[model samples]
Structures are given as C-alpha cells and as structure tokens.
Target chain A: MTYCVGVSLDAGLVLTSDSRTNAGIDNVSTYSKMYQCETTPDRFLVILSAGNLATTQAVIQQVKRDVHEGKPRNINNMAYLADVADYLGEILVNLIRKHNEQGGFIADATLVLGGQIKGREPNLYMIYPQGNYITSSSETPYLQIGESKYGKPVLDRFITRDASLEDAAICSLISMDSTMKSNASVGPPIEVLIYKRDQFTTPKHYKFDAEDPYLLAIRQEWAHHLNQAFRSMPRLEESQAQPNSYLRAL
Target chain B: MTYCVGVSLDAGLVLTSDSRTNAGIDNVSTYSKMYQCETTPDRFLVILSAGNLATTQAVIQQVKRDVHEGKPRNINNMAYLADVADYLGEILVNLIRKHNEQGGFIADATLVLGGQIKGREPNLYMIYPQGNYITSSSETPYLQIGESKYGKPVLDRFITRDASLEDAAICSLISMDSTMKSNASVGPPIEVLIYKRDQFTTPKHYKFDAEDPYLLAIRQEWAHHLNQAFRSMPRLEESQAQPNSYLRAL
Candidate 1:
C-alpha cells in the first residue's frame, strides 16, 4: 500500500509520498517512491507511484532508459506536460499487459506526474493503471493515489489554488501523517518535493525518517491542536433539548 | 451506503447512525437505521445496521416477529448477551444464503449490537454477514459498521472506557459528521441514542434532520475550530534547514 499526493498551486507544485511497501506482513520493505528527472535544463519532471512494486519499478526504469537511449518519444523531447503524462501512461499499460500474459497476477499501478516546461505553466496529472489520465483543475487543485480516504478531509478543507507552495507542502505532510497513524502499510521516511513555477531544476527536497525530530514535533503539535479544537466545539447536551422541543409541542 | 458507530463507556453506551439509503443515485430515500427493543423490563437491546437495505429490513422484521410469537429461542428468551449476538448472526447468515439462492444478487449486511441486561455490564458486538461476531475490548471500546474509515481518526484519538457517555456520544456525532462530509452516499437525518447503565427501558434518543439547527451549529463550530487549529500548527519552513545540515556535514 502507498499514499502519494500532489498539489498544484498558483505559487508552485507540492508532492509528497510514503516509502513503505509490503507484499504481506512478513514481506514489508522500504523504498523511495519519488522519482525526479531533469529531462533537460528547461524541462523538469517528478513521478510519484503507488500499487504493484514490480510494475512501477519497471515503468520508472523504462522511462529513464528512453531518455538515455534518445527514443523518438521520451520525456526530454515531449512538447507539453500532458504529452509526458501520455508517454508515462503508455509505458505503464504496456508493462502491465506484458506481465499479465506471463502469469495470472495483477500488474496494475497508479502514478502522479507534475512538472513544468520553460514557457508553460506548472501542471499536475494523475495517471491511472488502465493507461488513462486526468489533470487537476482550479476547482480541485490536488490529486491523490492509494489509501486516500483517511487523509482526504483535511485536503478538502484547506487546499486551494491560492495557497503558497510551503503551506501546500505542510498540508501534504499532515495528510500523510494522518494516513500513517491510521494504516500500518504507509510509513516513513517521508519524501517531499516543492517546485517553484518555471524553475525547471531539482525541486526543494526533504526526507523524514520515522524518528526524525521535526516529524515528531509536527505530529505532536497537530494532535494537541486537534484535541483542543474538539474540546472547544459546542457540546451535544446543550442542544439535546431542542429535539425534544418538537415533541413537547405535539 | 451508511455509517453507524457504537461506543461502550463506563457511564453507558452511545450509538449514532445516518438515515440515508439508496438503491441507485436516482433512488435515494431516508429511513432510520437505529432499532431498539426492550424484550423484558430487565433486558434492553439496540441494533444499528448498514449494507443492503432489504436484507437488513428482513432481519429486523424477523427478530420482531420472533418476539411477538414467543419463539423458544428468540431474543426475549436468550440467557446471555452473547447468545443474542449469536442469534442475530445466525439469522443474518441464513437470510443472505436464502436470498443468494433465489438469484445471483448479493444480500449482505453488517450490524452493531449494544445494550445491557440486568445484573450484567453493558457491552457491544459487531455481527458480520458471515455469521460470526466480535465484541469490543476495554482498550478499544467502540465498534463501527458501514463506510467507517472517514470517521475513525477522532474515535481512535478520544474513545476510551473511562469516557463519559455524553462525551462518547459527542465523539460519535463528530465521527458521523466527518463521514457525511467525505461521502455523499452517507447523508442525514442522523440518529443518536444514549443509554445509561442498568437502565432497561427507553434510552435518550435524538434525531437531527439535514436542516436541524443544533447539528448545523456543531458542524459550523467544528470546521471553524479545525481551520484555526491547522493555522496554529508549526510551519514546515522552520524545520527545512535541519535536513540540509546533515547533508552539508556529510
């Protein structure tokens, strides 16, 4: 299981992912799920993956190989960000199909692609295992893949197009923290990348292991704040008599 | 789709459920999912249900009929609370099997049963569609059924055997509110029932329609507090340079 989230903001793009991977309880391992490619000085791209480990690794290796081999349709030479998304989608579909024919196992994988070209705006796309992809809109500025439900309410409440890249990254970490607390399959070291629009170079990156002091501080502070917030909310007993009022009227 | 939660506390038990039911998008309707039966003056029971509506309705009707007919092994005649759980489990499994044989449609339902009989402590059980059931523990004093994930985090943080019944009820309401915000399939009028320890007759019940003033007040106040809490948490930029310090040292 994995949890990867990418937010496209007016200031830039923020992407975060958990590093835990497991085939079963006994087969748990940790691996980096964030891939960064400076396809060219003008073109920078990041890929965050979830689902089948073998399939995602193969897809990443193929993408790197295409750039090295100077293939006709590689990320380096793609004309638009959407074209890069389409290229990744094609690679994913072909790999899954090849594996499905070899035996009877699921080879599905999901991915998020976010980056910018020199003259164009930064963009974010979520590529499905079936080789289809959808981009984020102004109304919905973020996209998530894998173990999404536990962390979604916070994003729905706080994420907006106007949020700063730093704020978006903070919200993403909070989201990942909530998921890790609820699910054992998603763990650290957490990887986060923040890209300022049009920079087209390696983005600001940070990794936090399970015992990292800063991560622990954030977790503790968030929990404290949440408990305080809950306590401050109006109590149910204060409102209980309102429902009974109608009964009294009858 | 539905969301129902039951919590067992030192003071008593708290159960909350949403009222929405739907066969398809066009066929949405509202029906109470909370059922209470006082089989005898000393024995009280409450059942909260989710899953296929027809299957749940049939199971509830059968239980009512058995009580009316004075069946030899009915809920009214059960000796222990566990026996009542077993009885409900048996009825659920038999009904699902009978319907599955009629055609090729699923007839699955999940339920949470909570109550107390005189001379026994209050308790809670979750009955699965496969004719098995599990009870809540002191460490984990709550049981949930139907679209449960969205509402789980708060309960994981706040619920304990030491919590007052009113506090448990408030937490349950917050959990249901979170679920309703995240899932359109689980709507309201919401139903909540709070039972005091050793009381065998009617529990305190409250029904909140979508436009209920108290429900709206809680929702608005909770959201405002959450936003404030998020803003108060420490920012990521304050911790950004620590990761770089290690990299520079290396």
Candidate 2:
C-alpha cells in the first residue's frame, strides 16, 4: 500500500507521494513515485502514483515509449491536463491488458496528474485502475489515493482555493503525518512537488525523511494541542440539564 | 456503518460512538450504539458497538435476558470485566449462528467493552465477529472498530494511562471527525460515554449533534492548530544546517 495526495489550489498544485512499498512486513523497499513530463516552458505535467509498483512502472514505461516514438501517439500531443490524464489512463489500461495476456499477475494502481498546459488554467486529475479519471475542482479541490483516510479530515476542514501554496504544502505534509502514524503501509522518504500557477515549467521538490525536525515538532505539538484542547472542553454540568435539548430544538 | 472508539486512561475510560447506521445511502437511520450492563455500584460494564445493528442489539438483549433470568448467569456471577467480554462474545457468536441457521441476512459487527468490575481496575476489550475478544494494555491502551483507521492516529500518539477521561473523550471525537470526513458511511448524532475508575456505577453519557457548539469550536481550532503547526516547521535549510546533520551522515 502507498499514500499519495494532490491538492489543486488557486496558487497552483501540491502533490506528495510516499516511497515505501511493501509486499509484507519484512519486504519493504523504496521507490520514487513522482514523475515529470515536459514538452517546453508552455507545457508541464507531474504525476504522483500509488498502488501496485509493477502496474505504475509499466504505465510510465509505456508513456515513455510513446514519447520516444513521438508522432500522433505521444503524450506531447496531449494538449490539456485532461488529455494527459486520459493518455496516462490509456497507458495503464494497455499495460494491464498486455500483462494479463501473458498470464502472470496484474497490479492495481492509480495516478494523480496535475499541471498547466499553455493556454488553459491549471488542473488536477486522479486516474483510476480501470482507466477512468475525475478532475478536481473548487467543490472538491483535492484527491488522495491509498492510505488516505487518516489525513483527510484536516484537508476536508481547511483546504480551499484561497489557501496559499506555502500553506497547502504544509497541509499536505500534516495529512501525510497523520497517515504515517496510523498506517505502517505508508512511511517516510516522501516526495513533495509544488508547482506555482503559470510557472508551469518548474516546480520545487522536497524529499522528507522520518527524523525531519519540523515533521517531528508538528507531531509533538499537534498531540499536545489536542490534549490541551480536550482538557478545555466545557465539562458536563452535574445537574440534569436536558441531555437532548439541542436535538429536541432541532 | 459506524465509528466507535474506546480509550483506557489513568482518569478512567472514555468511549465514543457515532449513531448512524445504513444499509446504503437511501436506507440511513439513527440507532443507539452504546449500551450499559451496569448492575450499578457492584459492576459497571459499557458496550460500545459498531457494525451490524441487528447483531449488537441481539447481543445486548441476550445480556439483558441473562440478568433478568438471574443467579447462574447474572452480573453477580460474571466475576470480572474479562468475563463480561467473554459473555458478550459468546452471545454474539450464538446470535450469528442463530441468524445464519435461520437463513436470515446477517452482517458482521464488532464490539468494544470497558469499565470496572467493582474490585479491580478499569479495563477495555474489543470483541470481534467470531466472538473472540482482545484486551487493552500498557502497550496497546485503546481499541476501535468500524471505521477505525481515520481516527486511529491521534490515539496512537496521545492516549496514555494518565490521560483524563475528558481528554480521551476529546481525542476520540477528533478521531471520529477524521473518520466522518473520509467515509460517508459514518456520521453525526454522536454518543459519548465516560467511566471514572472505581466508581463502579452509572457513567456519564453525552450526545452531540452535528452542530454542537463545543464540537464546532474544537473542529475549527484543531484545523487552525494543525495548519499553524505545519507552517511552524523549519525549512530544509534550517533542518540541514546542523553540524551533526544525521541526514547528511545517512
């Protein structure tokens, strides 16, 4: 299992993926899940993948092959972020089909793609195992796959288009931290890619490790704050105040 | 679906559960998931359940019947909290078997039980579908079932024996908030029960609707604290500036 999250914000897009992959408790390994596809300053795309490593790698390899063979069948021809998502979905579907034709094993995988194409606004999409995809929008401005629930509450409550890129970056990491605490399936050595809108060609990338001080401090303080917050919740009055007063009023 | 969490703290035990039950979105309804088998003063046992409502109700009814029958299987003869968990588990197994034997539809469910047994310290246990149960301890001080993962991180980081019942209550709600955000299957009209150690009597129970002012405040403030904590993390430069940089050594 893996945890990958991508947030589409007014400033740009924030994408993150953890590197830990494990077939079992004893077989953990590290693999980079962030990939960049660029065809010049006007067109830039980033993909963060989760799920079966074989399926994702195969999909990426096929995409690379298509680009190398460059013609009518290349990702370079995919003019929009949606087009890119569709193209990647096609690659994954074809890879899964071809692999299953050989009768060995097929993998379950998902990919998140977000970036800007020359003339359009930035966009984000999540590509599913069966080659279907959904675009993120203001109503639902984020997408997460694999080990997603633990980190999701904070995102649901706080993330918005008005959010700053700096803040979104921090929010994504906090989400990842919650996931890491509850799930052994997702671990550190995480990749964070931040792309500012219109600055499509370049994005800042950071690799986070387990002992990263800021991560540790956030974990500690969040824990402390939660305890303190709980301590401060008004205690139930000893008198029998109508327990269902609010519900009855409703 | 349901979300239920139990924590064993030095101040006593905290149990919280959401009341939503659904066969599907169209079939959603509210059903109480928290039940107590307290004979008051002499023995106090609260069962917080998540999963099949029918199964939990059957188990509760069975326990009530045992008490109504008296003598051989009453609370007086249960002996300990462990015995109470076993009794509940046996009832669950029997209920499942009877439901299956009659060819009725039955969904799997899990129960979390904890409280004092008059003469001993407060204890917590989680009962599974098969009627087997596991107890909480120093190493594992909490138990959750039915939409557990999303709410698990906070408890993993903060729950301790010395934690106040109030603190446990808050943390569990925060966990529920996370689960509720990630999974539509769990939702509001939440129930919270607190057991103070050695009190051996009726525990305090609170019901919170979606708009409970205290809940709203914590949710808002928690979101702020999480974002602030994330922003407060030092940048990579400061993280890397240490002369004893462990990451560089790695």
Candidate 3:
C-alpha cells in the first residue's frame, strides 16, 4: 500500500509520497517511491509509483537504461510535459510487455508522473496499470494515486487552482496524515517535493517522520478543532421539526 | 454504493448513512440503508447496510419478517443489543444462503449495528458478508461500512469514547461529507441518528440534504479554516534543509 499525492497549483507543483511498502504486514520494508529524472537543468520530472514494487522498479530501470545507452527513442528527444507523460506511459507498457514475455513478476503497478519542461507550464498525470494515463486540467488541478480515498475529502474541500504553493503543500501533508491514520500499510518518513513554476533547476523536498513536532501538533489541533467545529454547528431538534412528510420518513 | 458510520461515545451512539444506490452511473436511485429494531424500553438496535441494494433489502426483509411473525428465534427470548446484532447477522446469512441456493447472486452487503440494551452499555458491531462480526471497543470506538475510506480520516482524527453526543453527531456528518465528496456513488440526503446514553426511548434523527444551509456552512467553514490553518504553518526553506539520503539516491 502507498499514498502519493501531486498537486498542480498556480504557484507551482507539489508532490508527496510515503516510503512504506508491505507484501504483508509482517513483511514490511521501507522503499522510496518517488524518483526524479533530470537529465538537463531545464527539464525535470518526478514519478510517484504505487502497487507491485518489482513492476515499478523494472519500469524505472528500463527507462533509465534506455536513457543511459543513449538510445534515440521517441521519449529521448525534446518534448513538452504532455509528451513526457505519453512517453512514460509507452515506456511502462513496453517494460510490462518485456516482463510478460519472460513470465511477469508483477501484475499490478501504476505510476504518476508530473512536472514541467523549460518552456511550458507544470502538469500532473496519473498512469494506470494498463499503461494509459490522464493529465490533470484546470478543473481538477490535482492527481492522487494509491490509497486515495482516505485523503480525498481534504483535497476536495480545500484545494483550488489559485491555491498557494504553501497551502498545497499543507493539503498534501494533511492528506498523507489521513491515509497514514486509517491504513496500516502506509507509514511515515514521507517525501514531499515542490517545484516553483518555470524553475526546473531545483525542486524543494522534505522528509517528515511521524514524531515531527509541527506535524504532531497539526494532527492534534485538527482533531480538537474538528470536535469544536462540530459542537458549534446547529443541531436540529425534535421540537424544531415541522409537520412535513419527508421528516416523517426519517 | 453507500457510506454509513457508527460511533460509540461516552454519551451514546451516533450513526449516519447516505441514501444513494447505483447499479452504474446511469442507473442511480434513492434508497434508505438504515433499519431500526427496538422492543422499545428493552433494546434499541439500528442496522446500516451497504452494497448491492437487492441483497441488502432481502436481508432486511427477512429479519423484519421474522420479528413480525413472532418466531421463537435467538432474538425472541433475548431482547438485548448483542442479541439483536446476532439475530441480524443470522438473518443475513440465511437470506444469502437461500438466494445463493436458488440462483447465483452476489450477496456482499455489510452491516453496522450499534445500540444500548437494558443491561449493557452501548455496543457497536460491524457485520460482514459472511455473517461474522467485530465489536467496537475503547480503542476502536467507531465502526463504518460501505464507502468507508473517504470519511475515515475525520473519524481517526476526532472520534473518541469520551466525546460528547453533540460532538459525535458533528463528526458523523463531517465524515459523511468527506465520503460524498470523494465518491459520487454516496451522495446527499443524509440520515443521522443519535442515541443518547441510557436514553433508548428517545433517539434524535435528522435528514440533511446537499443544499441544507447549515451543512453548506459547515463545509464552507471547514474549507476556510483548513486554508487558514495551512497558511499559518511555517514553510521549509532551502537553508533549513538537512541531508536527505533519499534525494541523494535519486
């Protein structure tokens, strides 16, 4: 199980991934799921993967090996963010095909690649196990893969295109906190990477442990605030009930 | 699809269920997933169902019919909350078996039963498709079935046995709101039932629609507070960066 979230905001793009992988509860291991491909100073890419570790590692290896051997493939040439997404999908499919030819080791591994080249705006994409992918647009503005449900509500309630990079980062962390609480398979030492728009040279990254003071404080405060919020909300009582047919059905 | 959450607080029990059923995106309908069985002053049992509408309805019908006929069953003699849960599970299994024996039907509905008997404190149990169930305790004071993830974070962050009834009710609503945002299958027209401790005769029931002014305000206020909270948190700067071995590997 993994929890990885990438948000594309007006200021920049924010990416966060957890490092806990478990074949079973007893077989837990720490494995970093975020990979960066920065062959040039101007072009940058971040890949957050979830599902079968072997399949994702194999796919990453294949792409790196291709880039290593200087193979003049379609993805090797200069392309925009969308082209990079397509190339990543094609590479995943080809890798899966190669693995299948040799008795596939992993049947399920999906990847999410998001970043920008020097010329265009930042973008985010979620790739399926079938090697198909979809990019986030203005309306969506965010993409999350792996154990997404626990964290989705916060994103839906808070995230917007005009949101600041700092706010996006906080939302991703809050989202990760949600996943970590409900799910045992996902644990801490989370990796958060941020890239300012048009600045492809360096990306901001942070690794948060479970005991981080601020993180712990935020979780506790959020819980307290939530209870307070609920109590403050007006409670509908039986006395206020009007003689309505719908109220009778309740 | 449905989203139902039941919490056991020191004050009493809180249960909320959405009223949306969909075979697919096109074939969506409105159906109540909550069932109440009370011998009045003796026992108060509420069952929330999720999964295939037909299967859930059949299970509920079988249980209700058995009670109506005054059968000499497990629940007939023992009018307790735990006995009620057992009776409900048995009816579910019998209905599933009968349906399966007649023809192949997917009987994969889950039930969350919570209430207080005359002799015991409030108890919450999650009934599985196999008719087996797990009870909620101090450590796990809440039980949720069907589309449970989106709403899980709020519960994990806020729910506690010491929480007041008002707080529990608010938590349940917030959890439902989260589920509805992430999953279109579980939508509004929410049903909330609050059972105060030792007050089995009087249960507070409220139905909230998507356009409910208070609910809308809660959602809006929550979103606003979240953004404000995130902005107040400090951002990590490049100078504060320590050694990140994970990034070194990349």
lDDT of each: 0.86, 0.77, 0.78
Clashes per prediction? 0, 1, 0
| lDDT (10s digit) by residue, model 1, range B40-84 | 788879899999989888888888888888899888877788999
Predicted structure with the largest TM-score when compared to the true one: 1
Order of the predicted models by DockQ, top scorer first: 3, 1, 2
Worst 10 residues of 1 chain B by lDDT: B241-250
Candidate 3 per-residue lDDT, tens place, A164-243, comes to 78778878888888888899999888888888898876777787777876567667766666555555666656653223
* Candidate 3 residue B45 C-alpha distance from true site, Å: 1.9
Q: Mind sharing the TM-score for model 1?
A: 0.95
Better of 1 and 2 by TM-score: 1
Per-residue lDDT tens digits for candidate 2, residues B4-81, read: 988888788888889889977899998878776646467777788887778788777777777777748765577788
User: Which TM-score does chain B of candidate 1 obtain?
Assistant: 0.95
lDDT of 2 by residue, A1-250 (tens): 7898899998889888888998878999988788776455677777888888888877777777777777586767767778888888888887778777886677778899888888899889999989999999897899998888888876876689888876777778878888888888898887777778888655777777888776686667766765565555555544522243111100
Docking class of 2: acceptable
Measured with C-alpha atoms, the lDDT of residue B144 in candidate 2 is 88
Distance from true location, Cα of B28 in model 3, Å: 1.7
Q: Encode model 1's per-residue lDDT on A1-250: one tens digit a residue.
A: 9999999999989989999999988899998888886467888788999999999999888888887898898988888999999999999999999999997677899999999988899999999989889999999999999999888878888899999887788888888998898889999999888888978765788898999877898889889988887777677764463343111100
Q: Give the better candidate number (2 or 3) by lDDT.
A: 3
